[model samples]
Target chain A: MQVHELRLPLRAEDIRKLKEGDKVLLSGIIYTARDQAHKKLIELIEKGVDLPFKLRETAIFYCGPSPKAEGKVCGAIGPTTSSRMDGLTLPLLQQGLKVIIGKGERSAECERQIREHGAVYLTAIGGISAVLARTIVSCETYLWEELGAEAVYRMELDRLPCYVGIVGD
Target chain B: MRYLKAEDIQKALTQAICQISYESDPKAVERMRTAHEQSNHELERDVLGAILENNELAAIDNIPLCQDTGCTVIIAEMGRELVIEGATLQEIADRAAAEAQGKCPLRASISYDPLFRRKNSGNNSPAIVHIRQVEGKRLKLKIAQKGGGAENMSFLMMLSPATPLEKIKEQIVQRIVESGSRACPPLVVGIGIGGNFERCALLAKEALFEELGRKHPDEHYAALEQEILSMINKCGKGAQGMGGGLTALAVHVLHEACHIASLPIAVNLQCHAHRHVDIEL
Candidate 1:
């Protein structure tokens, strides 16, 4: 596997260069969203209201960090199963979600949409939460405090390692 | 009659809870290392290497090994001869589990109920405790912080008693292979081959507590375990389903006699990050 260091806010051209089995160490910003957050975010999108973060030319990690300790920026954070969000994903990619990072495979519908929208899917090793969290430089809850861990968190990551699972034509 | 304090059980349970949260069982660690060494895929190797490193870092940094610290599962084997003072075991376990949940601040994976009000119960309390009577005076507790991912892939099928053994095994291998990266290969799979509906599921879970890859004592079941392991590994799911030589670290089987008309089987899966511990009080 060839290792590549890539800065996030992945664009159409940058995503095209990635292929399956490539090891990517990503740095820059990402928004964390899980089950509940996906629902709320999509709801806002349908209502034509402002989203907590821009969805274009960006990446969203399907994970929730553990509660940070008193002095820590974040806790153990790992990719969740992407298939769970299959229903909520196409809209985001349509709005220009260039990259989706999570563990496991996506449903056929999501995979088709990923290719259609020129998006890339990446998977980090699941359960290695603490190791992955070390890559995060900072984390702040961006929206949905009521959802607690499921709330969207804006995270600035440095060299977060992941493997490309799917890439567009 | 000898009496043991509920506090003692609480204290022991508290320690066991934390031990699993921060560190995986040593045998589990050893199996992972072997998987890492054996896999041919570099992607698989790389991920396994990171997992092994994560184990060490989690201990050093005092953070949980996984964000999904999982729902607390405790199987308590109580001796018939021993007497308990203070609260019931369930109550003791709940309090101890709550205290540990606060200390580790493990995610509140549990909800108030399964449906309707799907709300986080906050402190990961009300541990799913299973108790049974055994022969010895010692109380044995098998605790696992089982995450939802692999457990979601666990399966139960009531195959026809008249069905051939080969077909039953094939069905299991097929479903598990279909799980792909979802169940978090390389996994430690616990399989229960016989018993009633619920008992079969319980047997599969109890089988997980058995020493990681230890074979069944019965030669027939041992051979079955080996066969299943080889077949599953040969599927090329490898570590994290990256495709390689290893998929499951171990496949443990436990079988019991079932009703003449029934043949129920349950497969309980544990991800590579199994935070499991055994405590004797």
Candidate 2:
């Protein structure tokens, strides 16, 4: 029942400093991606293409948000199932993507990769989209806009509440 | 029997889609509230409280509950003797979904091809419709906006007929506990047993629409539901796997007769804000 207060834009080292059951208010830029984006990112890796953004020291949020309402920051932001991104963790980590935030457990292989890369996984409350969305400051589609909700969105957040769930255990 | 028009179906589907997006079923809300009150872990309790509050905010704001508005599922129970005068039921359902997606401004989650083009269906159309005939003069429509977080966590076990009920409960509970925060804990566990592999899976999904915390009329199955609910809660998977008292608010089982050699079991896990509505017309 113990609780802790934490802040972000957190680093890989920051995440490693924490353990399981740490409550944090995350702020900064969280990129949104889902199954389609994961597939595309993996495909690009296969094709040996360069990524648009750096992955290291950055938190990759597993989310496919709704289109932002007029003059609003974001709409109904919530985490997607993280397990679906299991296959791409190693490749993404190899590319320096450090903090992985999503819901659910990591695959055995993903756990190994996370430990090796010194990464952390956070589970946000699912179905609490509106509450989650309130933390955002601005939103804009970055890539794969055609993918609709699956499109990669660059979101600026302000004290977005999240908790570290699984830390390689 | 009232011959419902396509427009009526369309309007109903649209309204239902929006209604369920943010609002939790009263039944589910009540169960979650009770479970949260009884929970032990503070983290799990917090998550449960947040979800319950989210439901209220969404209802007031009319916002989509989760970003993943989810694939639309429409279950229609028709009177055996009733007949529609205009379009086919399936067509109307699809049209309604498409119209709702556009007008409600719901996200377009459907894909044109699962493996190929993977293009957005654009309007969240072509809902998964299951129709059944019953001895009634009224038509019933039940709609649920199922989220992918929990949908992906669902599992099916094709057990040997010799598999004991204990083993069945073990598998279901293990998966649900292991699922933890992934499927959005403080969940509603829907179990479908006895049918063939596919039928059993469908039944599991179908069982999700049932009123939360309510048991089957059959005395035996009702006890099984309680047993499963008790076991899952004892795991301490809690609300969001943060460790709490009640991991699941309810465990609903829907079964059917199966082959003598097989005992197929399907587990359909639903998140805390289980949104669904039914109307009889």
Candidate 3:
């Protein structure tokens, strides 16, 4: 249960160091995606198309933020349930994705994949979007704008709070 | 007889939506604060503390409480003696929902179609409005912005009359345990017993509108609520399901007469970010 400050594009060493229940303050760039974006990402993988961003050593946060209010860099941003993305987890991990952040427990198979791939699953407090948004310094839609809040966002975070829910055995 | 203009209802709803989205109900906040104070585990206390802090930031910054902004659920109790001046209530609600999208930082969570199209409704219109007529000349509206995560975990069961109360308790606890961290505990559990299938579900949802920490009117039901709350907390799901002693903040039960030989139950869970508002006219 150590508290670690981690930067994104996480190294395999960083992933291995995390244990379940450890607190983390994540910083740097993280990609955002939800169920819809996962579906599309999977489709692109199946078609042998290159993704918009590199998956290796990168972290993806499962979230769909509310619309930004006046002068705010981002709107309320919080984690959605991770189980909803279980079906897409293995494929993403196999692509060398290293960190997954969301709320709730993942499937047994997803946990196994995390261990096998040397990845980690972190959880943000569900429903605490406003607090989470304060940590986001900037956000830009990188893809799938038509999906609105479900679009893939390239976010710059500073000390975004989370916990290590699942770590590679 | 009193006459309330339909436009007034629309304006009131718009204001209510913004208020509920930006600031959590004070009673719900106090209950969470109490849960924080009662938690023995360090992680549980930290989690509960974060929830309270998040709510405060939302109020100060004037932002939607959560990213899921939720589907607007409006329950209206209209007095029979009150006459609506202009538009239909449904139309007024829709207009208000659209106005909310324009004025607030709310996400457009509702889909235009549930099936093939699966398109976002854009403005978050077409609120789920439930209207009932009452005796007085005043109109009361209770608005809840129901997040998708917790709403997805709601459950319903039909048990035989011969089934013991213990069985019902077991089912309730089992459902909450299975829901785990997904429904976002420390939660408020709403239990509806006795109504038919659909009615039971509605009763369960309606029960969620009850003020946190308020007991059921019936002494028996109040005792049952306490028992169920204890049972759920014992599951060790804790805050954010990270293993703690405060999984549930409260359990509310609303029961009605049921058909012979049938006992129906519905469980609706609300997340820690209980965003709801009430308006009276």
Best by lDDT: 3
Candidate 2 lDDT tens digits, A121-148: 7777778877877777888899988888
Regions more than 4 Å wrong, model 1: none
Cα displacement (angstroms), candidate 1, residue B80, comes to 1.3
lDDT by residue for model 2 (B189-275), tens: 889988798898888988888877776998989999999999998887777777877678788889899999888999998887787
lDDT of each prediction vs. the true structure?
0.87, 0.79, 0.88
Residue B260 displacement in candidate 3 (angstroms): 0.4
Query: Could you tell me which residue pairs clash in candidate 1?
Result: none
Q: Residue A18 CA error for candidate 2 (Å)?
A: 1.6
- Which ranges in model 3 have alpha carbons more than 4 Å from their true place? none
B130-242 per-residue lDDT for model 1 (tens digits) = 99999978888899999988999999999899998889889999989999998887888999988899999999999999998786899999999999999998898888899
Identify the runs in model 2 with alpha carbons over 4 angstroms from their true place: A1-13, A42-50, A166-169
Q: Indicate the worst ten consecutive residues by lDDT in candidate 3 chain B.
A: B31-40
Query: What does the lDDT read for residue B24 in candidate 1?
Result: 80
Q: Write the per-residue lDDT of candidate 3 for residues B127-151, one digit (tens) a residue.
A: 9999989999989998998999899
